[model samples]
Target: MSIMALTPPPIPRDGPLLRVDRLRQWFSSGGFMSPRLTVRAVEDVTFEIGRGEILGLVGESGSGKSTLGRAVLRVTDLTDGRVVFDGQDVSTLSKRQLRPLRARMQMIFQDPFASLNPRMTVGQIVGAPLRIQNPGISRSEVEARVGDALRTVGLADSHAERYPHEFSGGQRQRIGIARAFVLAPDFLVADEPVSALDVSIQAQVVNLLMEIKRKLDLTILFISHDLAVVGHVCDRVAVMYLGRIVEIADTRTLFRNPRHPYTEALFSAVPVADPSRRRQRILLKGDLPSPLAPPSGCAFRTRCRYAIPACAEAVPPLAHIGGGHQKACIRDDLALQPAC
Candidate 1:
């Protein structure tokens, strides 16, 4: 059976299902006085996922989306800020205190093959969490729950005795999903769940996620670079860049009218189906900045077409722009092109 990197915990019945306040996750290297460098993977990010909300986190590679996910789950400790899950402060919880709560929070890793234990049977993989959290549970009960979870993910019962190596990529991912859902977790962090799958398989998995969310009443943090997938499955979207969120709004609002320059650039790249509506790609100037030493003031100022002298003076706050839409860019006069 696969083991979690760190045991997680649970929360209360009210408030935003998950509230992240000024969360920062930083890692330092060179302990032996080699001019230690710290990678600011997640810096002062704040967001909320209400009950049964699938909040999509969209960003380019190395933008710190995964790190933020792990930190929110307390799979890794945070360097600063607070993470409140279900009203409880998971960041302050100890391992012993977190273990029982682990059953309530789960993670769906990006690589289906790597996340599962190749040597273990599917039943073992799915039943592991129930056994760990409920050590007193009967063997038959574990088997029953495992079977149900497998069925829910569209796998047959006989396949439970088989190993992950015996399945296709999609089936392996289904097994991973079975394992994640077996615990009936209240909150899930699905990190690039469908990225490794084919286009067709991606739809199947995404549909499965939507169905399961309805069945489980789950609150999810759906992290992906695929804006199309995010648009289809997410209620709201938050765009991340250089370890910070640049824009956040309801899916329709953000897709129809992105306020941040980075968001506008990102949306412009997404392929539109209709030939009549070709989006002019807003090609970015350079690669992502190094997380170790990010640019000053506006991290995106170097590439932003609307950047000015004041942009390099201080970091722009993620401020409300009206009607629940929020943006980090300081300029409010420039009109951004609508991608779709």
Candidate 2:
């Protein structure tokens, strides 16, 4: 089944389920005596995830895709910016104030083994969230919910008695998914959930996530470095470079015609299955620059093939090209045809 066909409708313009405006997440490195340095993990990033939509956050390992996902869910404190979830600005909410909101938002971490506790059984691991969130609920109800959640992710009640070490990577990931969904959260941050699993298991996890999203009407921020996976699962994709969003659009449009050079380079790397089709790989030069000292203007200008003098003058804004597609580059002459 085509994952795109299962995607829910676009987020209504009147109000989005989640809104991130000018989000910046900077980490302070160095001691008080040493020169104070700032690592811009995420900067000036802004986007929206509509209700029941899967928005893919695709980028290189250090491009801040994971950090952006965490920041959106307020898992990490923002350096500067606003995160409005369900019409409330969650950025300013205190821990006590944010307690109730925690039930509505959850995260499925990247590492299944690390995220799951070896000391606890699958039942304990999955039901932990419920025990903390709804303390008044009886043990039978929590166990029933945990069983239901396990079944939802394709695991059985018998599997809940097993420890994390007993199951394979894929099954452990399913446990993680069940834990995240135990609260029936409206928003979920799946940070590279399938990246560590076996190639054969990746598709199963992706399909399970798609099924869960559709069945529960959940909005997800799916973060991954794999463009093929992102293209297969997401409705809309936001391409990140260094610490900023370089391009964003619906899946079909972005795949057919990418505007940003960074995005083009990324799309070029996706392996094509057809032997007859020849794809021209756009080779990006140099390693990703250090976030502590990024380029003055566009961070990607140094590696961009079609970069111009204007690219060094100012950080290009994400301007509309056409059809709700937006790019951050200033150049307009370059044509980057779709490789796939």
Best by TM-score: 1
Position 304, candidate 2: lDDT: 84
Tens digit of lDDT per residue, candidate 2, span 1-340?
8999899988554577899999999999787889889999999988888888899999998999988988888877889999999889999788888889999999988899899988999999999999999889899998899999999999999888889999999999999999998998999999999999999999999999988898889999999988989999999999999999999999989999998988889998998999899878888888999999899889998998887788888999989888889999888877897846
- 253-295 per-residue lDDT for model 1 (tens digits): 9998989999999988988899887557898998898999899
Q: Which pairs clash inside model 1?
A: 12-86
TM-score of 2: 0.94
- Cα lDDT for residue 79, model 1? 94
All candidates' lDDT scores? 0.91, 0.91
Angstrom error of the Cα, residue 295, model 1: value is: 0.5
Superposed on all Cα atoms, the candidates' RMSDs to the truth, in angstroms, are 6.4, 6.5
Question: What residue pairs are clashing in model 2?
Answer: none
